[model samples]
Target: MTYFFPKVRQAQQHGWKGQGNKAGGWQEMSRVGAGARLFEATAVGIALLCLGARLEASELRKSPVVRAVERASPAVVNVSTEQEMQRRPGMFPGFRGDSLFEEFFRDFLSPFPRGQARTSLGSGVIVDPKGMVLTNEHVVQGASSIKVTLSDQREYQARLVGADPPSDLAVLLIETKEKLPVIPMGRSNDLMIGETVIAIGNPFGLSHTVTTGVISALNRSIRTESRVYKDFIQTDAAINPGNSGGPLLNIDGELIGINTAIYQKAQGVGFAIPIDRAKRIMRELIEHGEVHPAWIGVEVQSMDEALARSFGLQGRKGVLVTQVAQGGPAQRAGLRKGDLILSVGSSKITSRQEFLEALSAYTGGSQISLGVVRDGREMEVKLKAESLSTQEAVRMAERQLGFTVDAVNQASKKERRAYSMSGVVVRSVEPQSLSYRVGIREGDLIRQINDKEIRSLEDYQTAMARALRRESVTLLVQRGSYGYYLTLELGGGG
Candidate 1:
């Protein structure tokens, strides 16, 4: 306590100097008594602090939380992104549909105006000494240019490695050539509730702002428009809009999570991606440019105690298989309707989220053992999960067709769109291409081609190959769940 109150003690000693030289001996002694009383009060306060009441000022400055910020600040960065969005043709000065309109407005509808330049700010963490940085996908999505400013004020132009919108994570690379400071990574799996945590980010353009709180919850579920990743670390770390993708550190100054989202309506409620999950994603993005999702082709329902009884089961111990995809890994491995999946590998399945999580651990071509219950019997089955990279499906659509397409199960570049069935989505149609003229515009799903219903990537490709053989083809398309017919006639060599 005296260490924290040295200035007060020094002032008291100085204040009594002149009074002692004067005739006011009694006044000087009274001042000494006052100083002694103050010292006693300070001692009591320090005693209370030691008893876990509060922290002394000097001790607070040297706390673990402050030390964590000092250790991690060098790895934090401020991200600024500038994107040039293409401007479309706006309405002309004159109106009409024919000769007069075209004649009067010859200079109108000329070349589109220059693309609008938009700038945004966010936070990022330097994860590697090789100049690899991690941030939120939304922070740099569609950015024509990105600039990263380090804690030391060194700036560099960043290149996008890859971005996954579903995960809301993006990686950027800068050619710094020299070694960069990095934060020590910590394990979120070992994190306990109410453990001390620190968040450092650029909130509202405020760079390297530090906030501290306790881990409020773990494995929190976040629901967006189209997807949900059930593992998040909830903290009250004052994460703001621009704080997205910053580091969430443990008391040891090691990163345990990434600040991602905050509820607008609720105060002190913020969410972060656990560092354990992010490590895998970062490795995948660096190696493959994207994280591939592992999927088992089946429709599953969570079994409740009542539902288990109705299906003649004992307790709520497994997920029920309502339907299995034909020619899929589940069906090929003898999985059938009405079979109950009791466990995957060594982990028991109790919810849809848990089952999906277990299945996600295995990649394509990997063999997995499933413990299933058939009619009046329990059984073990082994199968190979059979999805090539879902990104490959998207790349196929873009390469073979005159447009980019999206699938229901794909991790989009910028969003998680709602797609109920397995059909290829027309994301962007090439200008003046047959797809554009045929009313096959963006947002249309090629549901069927000449009665060959498109249900998968294989079906879409086969139908497209058949359509290429004809000069014209009729396609049944679904636009926003509304079905319609479109006839596309191609010119020779188109």
Candidate 2:
């Protein structure tokens, strides 16, 4: 519970009771008239009072999140992730590294911890009566073991059902002999800015922690470890690190979002994945093994005020198509660079996020209706979406990393140029990432593995062979601005 009051108020109007001595002053007959008006106002006020009371009673009854926490708490579980540490060679070997001293001293001295477990805890909302759960993708990223404990103190080893890092959401499945009570999902699109929202999660590993606040804002964008998730619901709902993956519910106990992140340094600033997006991902994860995105073969940029005028954009709406991929769906549909996409199907596409979101609703091979504006002319086109390959999906996911990567496709000249390296090239650094943490990215032209200057596939192979043997190794590299080294620690078993 965070609380804030508005800083401004509307001015109230005051009137004289009646005309007394003068026209605007109180007088006997005027007083009688004023009394009648007061009587009417009093009756109205009483009626309003009764109506307010009734509404309050109804709201109290409908606030199921508040009422049902005690019962649902048993289903809301706490999760902890763990991974084994890689073994690192010691400063002095054959001190027979088998002693506790070897374990403790080696772990403490080595750049990478040895046999140590990196752990994180978070909360989850049970969505299926069979013990299937929902949580944030970050909560379980890189985790080799996932342990879930129910409110009743019973524990289970959970398996990852599916996860969408783009949306920063994940789902887990635990087979339990007993039935579980799942929370109902509510329509987050219907939520208002000031409507009450309840967050139930295990913050700081505290089970079933409940917090309340109002919807602070909507359509927020937050950068996670893997991607930039857009259209998040903002709330001052006392969310913390462990709160990630818990359900953000409305007064009726219907889930509106999946609590995902909070500003560590800022108070009352938290974010959640809107239930609508979560629902879409959940469907794909349950149906396929992964979430599939709708792809239009075009690079898009948002139409800002300055760019809109420069491009002579009409009506100040739609996203600018910067580049249309050759032979892609967009190019085949006749979409060209400098064109502005106005809509997908019936939904309007005003920004890049909106354009992407609108397309996510459909799958490959579906005929997509698009409206575009080009050279002062309005045009429409229908495109048949092609099913994206796993490689393509990986490329799309990498885009959120703010890096330039090329898949290994030697057929096309452009692809050959881009795919010279077996792995994607590091074009830029996203603010949050292990690569960024180590300070090695952006225009680096990643050429080698540990101690091996790599110019070709054989070089990379030889380097990886040596690097994988050690717990941690340094990548010798060159950058556009300067040359440096990057030490990468291979985390425990995945």
Best by lDDT: 1
Residue pairs with backbone overlap in model 1: none
lDDT of each: 0.74, 0.68
Q: Give the per-residue lDDT digits (tens) of candidate 2, residues 51-122.
A: 999999988785555575554466678988997767765656767646876777765777657567889999
In TM-score terms, candidate 1 sits at 0.60
Candidate 2's C-alpha runs over 4 A off are: 1-65, 68-74, 92-114, 224-226, 301-311, 314-318, 322-338, 342-387, 390-494
- In order of appearance, the predictions have TM-scores of 0.60, 0.60
Deviation (Å) of 132 in candidate 2: 2.2
How far off is residue 4 in model 2, in Å? 63
Worst 10 residues of 2 by lDDT: 4-13
Q: Count the backbone clashes (under 3 Å) in each candidate.
A: 0, 6
Which ten residues in a row are the worst by lDDT in model 1?
392-401
